[model samples]
Target chain A: MNNHVILDVQNLKKYFQVGKNLTLKAVDDVSFQLHEGETLGLVGESGCGKTTCGRTCLGLYSRTDGKVLYKGQDVHLMKGAEKFAFKKEAQMIFQDPYASLNPRMTVSDIVAEGIDIHKLAANKKERDEKIFHYLNLVGLNKEHANRFVHEFSGGQRQRIGIARALAVEPKFMVLDEPISALDVSIQAQIVNLLIKLQKEMGLTYLFVAHDLSMVKHISDRVAVMYLGSMVEITTSEELYENPLHPYTKALLSAIPIPDPDVELQREQTRIKLEGDVPSPINPAPGCRFKGRCKYAKAICSEQTPQLKDMGNGHCVACHLYNQ
Target chain B: MSKLLEVKNLRVSYHTYAGEVQSVRGVTFDVEEGEAIAIVGESGCGKSVTAKSIMGLIKTPPGEIKAGSEILYRGENILNYDKKQMSHYRGGESAIIFQDALAALNPTMTVGKQIVENLMMHRKTIMVDGKEVKLTKRLAMQEAVKMLKMVGIPNAEQRAKQYPHEYSGGMRQRAMIAIAFACQPKLLIADEPTTALDVTIQAQIMDLIKDLQKQLNTSVILITHDLGVVANVAKRIVVMYSGNIVERGNARDIFYHPKHPYTCALLEAVPRLDLKNKQELASIEGTPPDLLAPPKGCPFSTRCKYCMEICCEQAPAATDFGDGHEAACWLHHPLAPKDDVPFKTEVRHE
Candidate 1:
């Protein structure tokens, strides 16, 4: 990996044996790279393996196959002290702050938990200073250090989560729908805080969310996932302006514009998919979206499409652009 | 156009051990017949409380409806209605769709059974050609299946037998819509129905609600924090802030050209897909004031970017801006002294 590429995931596959004969392919052959100081947005519906992929990348869930390359080395191959060091370099900010944090611990102890585990702090005074520093970094005051998680609001609790993630001073962070559980007003504050911290710390982020508007705002590049595969990946502006994949178009069109006059004139006709998303346990041989895809053809059902570059770093996994 | 529901100076408070926490403060808005009105605001803005107030669903003890509260459903004071009268109104003339599908639905009961129970309760008898006929449980079940089909649930008959947990988030929402419309209520109050759902599912649910509203001619009160969801579905918009109707106007008027500062701040706060360049997403600075002892003047004075001394000193009364557009802010109030600072629309790009 080059200096531009902070973390590179290649053909990552994670599967689980659900029963006697069935194998659930959670993340199948997923490949993406997070560039230094850039936010890469990962967007998909629920049960699409986006969460699983994030956890697998973080080493929280052991990968069934493939490699996670961080800073030019295979993450799984690292051993002993090197593997422990890698843990400090890559951290995650989870979706639900209420569930992610330890309810029993105070705010300071929660932020200091990682520091204590890694033995980063020199002494008790240094650890206390570090904890206060991180809490302030995420816009929390020193007084919040003594407060319990329950005392804080949803937004403040999320801020604490962010502060905990930042305490380790990780170069790359995986934000798993951080703002999905937050209120709209509070969401803006958190998103803005994340952007500020990213610039200040020169940090790289893999921001995963289902909100398109928010994804567009924060992401330098975006990777759109469906079922268990990545359908498209491109720069945020390019993806929004000149989408190549049919699914991308459908997703973009689905976003409700906040104006009634425009909405009235605009055709709100959704490409109504007949059935719910199929089970990931035993996915079909063809495109995962074949059943719901309006442009699906006979070939779509017979063969799985591969992600092919369409020039200017825009990649799509649909046969329609495969000429 | 005749008003279907009119909420006048509705105040709801939660009697916590700490104190009486006022949730909804002197909120007033009217929903016309066959019109879809969206109440858009952040959490704790009294959006849900307003909806609960209209439905007569506010739980007492912890939650208390203040003395001045007046909810007029078809020009009748619903707050004064007895239990029997209210029962006739609840789920019969008005129905509510809550946010959480799992919590809203009974896990043990199948979706079909729930819909059938509601249909039987609200519409036990139907009129056909001036003759009334009673509906059996079997007929109610069949009608429930049909209702599911109407909400665009494929394989409705088969899926209806499955419990709520068996259905996907999108399907459960559709089932909820089916139950809500099973009664054929004149007014449907959907409280953040799509907020808990994903974007794609959110779209589907919004479309479903719109389609059903058109078909049934049911006036809808869409309660949501998402401004995007409100833009398309609602004919009119009511913006609530700290339990007050800060702004009310046509959806287009509010989105395109907002008069109130709070409304403008809210619009700016939302992250838009079309925006290019990276700029800080706008956020309202302070937390909402404690409702028990709300600020004397404008509730939003502390957070308002263009706040003046008058904003903190005296409460601003609702000022009509003609064309049925109204806003409660010192900026628009004529008697209030004008500030030197002019309203600025500095477009921040990222």
Candidate 2:
């Protein structure tokens, strides 16, 4: 969307020790760049480390290796005042609205939490005005200011969460499946609000979700991850129209289109992925998806494939596409 | 076609401190033999309540099914069935599988044992040499493993010996399906069976359900809020809103020619994958109405764009669109405004 790079993630890896001899590679060898004022969608199935990647990029989780740079400043290396400024500049909107916000606190206080932490407002009068402004921005009224989290519905609570993130006036946001917990009718409402807010504020987004349709609609570029590794990254149109990776094709085929006619045509051509995603703990070498891949050969299980650009800025990591 | 199950004027309400919440108000539909129909609606729209009412899971202390309600199973009214008769009808004649497979399954019992228990309750005896004998546990366990393998769970013997937590989300759902079909019931109610799994796993489970339905020839009623999911699986679709059936038709009819504004709005609200460019989603403006004192007219009138004055005054009766398709909306009335639909809906006759 822009020439300026807002966030650059380089070979980021985040691991956890599950047992005495087991290590879970949640985010391994994942790298991407988020341009200024652009929404980059990170999509994968559950437990594929999309959420872990987003959190690691936001410096929420300590990385095991590599660096996350926000506007050329390393996010993990920053300490004291620099880290506080980075927090104010980049906010995270969590997945569960019911758990993200404090249930006992009023809506105004919940929205003002970021404002208070960043000292964006000086006095009580200024804080109230800022809170009301953000409330109205996210389509809430003044009457909801004093109401607790339990009094609102799931959609309204998600709006409250968005308002809290907007209160800090962040230039970038990491939305971790913000609409997954919401109902279908309510999901479009939040997506529309996010689109409008990004247009009005010129905010960059690192949208992490498993919903491919929503990702295709809202993102300028899309990245596909599998078993804690990015398999493909390209423009949204190119990625959806011509997916080069085998896992990406399978993931796209799995999504059920809401029309019977389309489903009738797709049923025969659909790729049925067998079994579940392999456990990420102490994973084997070579391609992580080789176990389920149809075109996996001897070379796929022997060596890991790196992301290779296939002209026009489209990158894919797969042994089948090796040239 | 014979009707496998008929729900007539089913009125279910919950008495709370505030008022009586009409969870399912006079819902009526029929599941023909060997047919697959989906009940699609948003959360709090009473789809789950209707399923629960049919299953007789409503607790009477705070919940009540009003008089004049009838749930006919194989031409008999099950609402009047006694405890022993009801228990016999529950797993023996009809079965239900829930959304959360982990919670619906027992944590302490092995997967095989659960299936064995269901089989023992429903299928107590088998005929051998023209004589009925009591089913042994060993025989039931063998049948349970066979049922597990039938649902596509590999290594069935070893997996059956493990508990529910040991199985993954899709596998647990498969085990649940195995138990539900073990009795060979006439009707199966799958309530959001794949809602907890991801898209890939969801596709696998949906395929499994489709295969099993054909194999057992059992009528299925799928309840879920996602319209995208029901398209491929359900033969007919029932669109519900605020405890009322706004529209019901064959899958193609509903997708091509949606009569009610709520159904049309739901179709346009979800973003489509086939569309290439970024487009504005036509989302509904407001939330569903509170069911405590339900609206007198159409429940979707508050959010409908073509809301006539008469719509707020009284509820519209079901207007038939032929071929067993019907929708309850004022727009279809002859005296109402003509050509009021904002979107051009194609009506293709096959």
Candidate that scores best on lDDT: 2
Give one digit per residue, the lDDT tens place, for model 1 in A1-323: 13488888999999999999899998999999887998899988888889899988888888999999998888878899998998998999999988998989999999999999998899999999999999988889999999999988889999999999898889999999999998888889999999989989999999988888899999989999988899999999999999888878878877876766666755645444445668998888989988888899999999999999999889999999887
Listed for each candidate, the true contacts retained, as a fraction, are 0.73, 0.78
- Pairing residues by index, what is the TM-score of model 1? 0.96
Give the CA lDDT, 0 to 100, for residue B199 in model 1. 72
Give me candidate 2's interface root-mean-square deviation: 0.7
Residue pairs with backbone atoms closer than 3 Å in model 1 (clashes): B277-B350, B278-B350, B279-B350
List CA RMSD, all candidates: 3.2, 1.6
DockQ scores for all predicted structures: 0.70, 0.86
Q: Candidate 2, after superposition: displacement of residue A296 in Å?
A: 0.9
TM-score of chain B of 2: 0.96
Which residue segments of model 2 deviate by more than 4 Å?
A: B127-134, B343-350
Per-residue alpha-carbon lDDT of candidate 1 for residues B202-265, written as tens digits (9 for 90 to 100): 8778888998899889999999988889888898899999888888988877887687888887
Per-residue lDDT of model 2, residues A58-176, tens digit only: 89999999999999999999999999999999999999999999988999999999999989999999999999999999999999999999999999999999999999999999999
Query: Once model 2 is optimally superposed onto the true structure by TM-score, how far is the C-alpha of residue A259 displaced, in angstroms?
Result: 1.0
For model 1, the stretches where C-alpha displacement exceeds 4 angstroms are A1-3, A268-274, B127-132, B334-350
TM-score of each: 0.96, 0.98
- The number of the candidate with the highest DockQ is 2
